[model samples]
Target: MKYIKEFEKKMNLGSDNQLANGHVEQASIPKENEGSVQTYVQLLKPERFYMFLEILIYCIVGHFIGYLIAPILKNYFYNNLEWY
Candidate 1:
């Protein structure tokens, strides 16, 4: 458990550094004030896209696991426990 926690801490720090670097790089790039669409496009860097993908995958996997486990838990509680 301690090793898992340590690994998670290091991964969080690495991601933080990646995000800080992305922000710094984004700030260094100049954008035109022509329209909101163009500005939004400028903000969509590749690293941000991958980060978004990672979040999407995590969400999908988490929901799938929850869906798979829900019925078993429901059945167990329905048969083995009583609620008032």
Candidate 2:
């Protein structure tokens, strides 16, 4: 029993009974940012700008495709259809 207790102590398995001998280290807490609101506002500005750019690109591409397909369809209908 004595040998088992000594073995447990050597393996640090008696942690529940042992008192801490060294200085206890603590985790450092992060400080709150005072300009966090302003930072978020700044982040949103670029997001809005990118969203506007994406919408503009979609509009331009859609109009360009429509312009290309319109003439081809018009010519096909004019040649193939017999109008009374």
What TM-score would each prediction reach against the true structure?
A: 0.47, 0.44
lDDT of 1 by residue, 1-84 (tens): 677557657656334224522343223233466555666576567888899999999999999999999999999999999888
Model 1 lDDT-worst window of ten: 20-29
lDDT of 2 by residue, 1-84 (tens): 798677767766544433344222432222465446664553355666999999999999999999999999999999999989
The most accurate candidate by TM-score is: 1
Candidate of highest lDDT: 1
The runs of at least 3 residues in candidate 1 whose Cα sits more than 4 Å from the true structure, single-residue gaps closed, are 1-44
**lDDT for 67 (candidate 2):** 100
Q: State the local distance difference test value for candidate 1.
A: 0.68
- Residue 2 of model 1, lDDT score: 79
Q: What's the residue-level lDDT of 69 in candidate 1?
A: 100
